[model samples]
Target: MTDRQWADWHRPQQHYLIEPRYLAGGGDIRHATEFLRASGWKDRSKTGGPLVFHNPDKLVRVVFDPLAQPGGWTVEGRATADRPSWEARFGTGTPVEIIAGLTDALTQQPTAHAPNVWAPLGTHGWEARRGQHVTAVSPDKSAFVQFHQSSPGQAHWWIGARTEHGRAWDAHLSPTTPLSLVQALTTALSDPRPVMRPLGNVPPSDRIRSTSVSVTPAQLGAWQQARLTAARTAMWARSAWTAARPRNRHPATAAPRVPAGHTTGRR
Candidate 1:
């Protein structure tokens, strides 16, 4: 291992290795082996390309790969022996203490963020708003998510995500979604990947057939004015066109209308 990789390996915190780090090919494997031995993590495999470290309980497994470059050391553990396993990766030479800390944390139940679950929206650069319910827009303003206290089909809190590009997806979720997961999802939303959602309630055609629009007196007056203006414009255009055209000696007869309250002059 190089001086920098060795320095990274002895660090106090695990933050540096959360993402992949490239390690030079030579001597890293021996360095990792010696470090794993000092940390009391046993080599699970007698023969292997990657060194696997396991605690006495075997609940946590940390894999150190000298060749894992372009990828970091991976730590896998379960909340309990019966619980599902979760994995995280670190850079080339992550400190053993940091990996152990993460392994311990993974074995515990997730912390729930409730009631004030949406409070972190602002921290992620999302603008919070109140419409029929509550909503928040992403930092870049490319996407938005709304939380409804209650809606026609849903009685509990449901949220929807939408983008300016006509992509819309929503889900019904309890307020207990883990704060960490929520943060991760919001971060992912900034990427180009689309969020998937299920179809929501659709009204039957019969119900839509009964729907009607109501127009007020003001609207009626506006409609009448628009029709009158169009009629006058059309009349003027016709007259102008006729005057510009050649006229014949014979005149055509036209019908005349009587006034509303008066008879025609010739009955």
Candidate 2:
């Protein structure tokens, strides 16, 4: 058999799926944070506490605190007098790309219909079990998505992806987290396109469990150039939006002063 056919025969189906950098998890925190900043989310981080960002209207907030229990990264959309609120969290071990999936949805315009999280997982041959709570596992058994009750009248969702060595990443979303954001993350996780990664960067355990495709230097360079072009296009869009909006002189948008007696360090 040719190398391509042989590799496909031995490879786990999930390996053939395209893994976008954002959904692949374990990306640099700066990518997501920078995107938010460019999209007009103000940085309101305190010197010692976790870094914080808030939307211009103050309805949405994102926090990065390595010290926080359960999750180091938290995103919250506060309820207004006429609206409800929502929250999503990610452990320090969670991928920054997965976190960005939510932020991307939050900053973008809404869609007419919600994206289907369960259907895509099912379509990809993930097994679903329903009882007190619902859980889905990828065919290769390296990934999972779950929804369960956290308390009376409280429900939450959890997603985790791992390698043979150990857990790679995980995230949590409260029941109130917007369905659109939830769909964005699920869609990313279940996409069936191959993700490009340097062979050297693949974890040893993952290499054992997945098939790696060789890409010529020229091909890799082209892929990188395409990504750069897309990023530049997004940057230009954000710049235009910023220029068009009226500058908010509200005191809330002003740079916050460090409070006395506050020392910055992970609790």
Candidate 3:
């Protein structure tokens, strides 16, 4: 990123927020700090304070705080076109343009290692990635899925889904969750034509509540059996209701009941 470009990235008029986990790793911090230092960016920080880098000739500056903990580091810049005085008083540009620029900067080969950050969402297109936790939204914004590893290394995957009607469902995948199943879910979520199964009206949070981090295969099997039983019960109830209902036939047009010798009609 150019000095001007970097400056533009942190323009006072713009704001950007990226979760800490995505950028908190030691490698990430080292890579970013080294990149900036090697690029001749001067460190004008005070004693025992967060590392601050700036180019005296340009309006760009970055601050890396190791003590920031969960918030990670904060970096800001401004383009040459942005007037610091004017922008500080009144916002110079929209967040969309600013975030787009940041995304572009991060996607570049050298900066890609810094962190994978997702911009704040408004109406559509939301995503966030932090370690084992990953969130993805469909292209049309009608569906969203959040995948995460509930256990540290038990090889378990929990998937949460939200449909157009706000219906939510979640399922636990085994250590051997098939790639085909994952791909199928992605395709189903991306495509709106075919209706997907297991995304019922009930929220997954309400239906599948696993107290433990890792769910055993036996537990999964038992849940499946219960679901099957519930489905059969529903079908039986429907059939019983149909059988109990009176037939829709007119009484006068129906066959007459014989009292004693009224079998002449039949003969």
Instruction: Please tell me which predicted candidate would have the highest lDDT against the true structure.
Output: 2
Ranking by lDDT: 2, 1, 3
Better of 1 and 3 by lDDT: 1
Which lDDT tens digits does candidate 1 get at residues 61-138?
A: 767665654445665554553344444555443333233323332222333432133444455445665555555655
Model 1 pairs whose backbones collide: 17-90, 17-91, 79-107
lDDT of each: 0.39, 0.63, 0.34
> lDDT tens digits, residues 1-267, model 2?
898866665554222222433234454577578777766679999888889999877989999988767647889888765446777877775656567777766766555563555766676666776555667777677777777656777678888877756777677787766666776777667666644444444444542334466555445446546644555566577568668874322111111122233222211
Better of 1 and 2 by TM-score: 2
Worst 10 residues of 2 by lDDT: 249-258
Q: What TM-score quantifies how close candidate 3 is to the native fold?
A: 0.25
Best by TM-score: 2
Provide the lowest-lDDT 10-residue window in model 1.
16-25
Number of the candidate with higher lDDT, 1 or 2 = 2
C-alpha-based local distance difference test score of model 2: 0.63
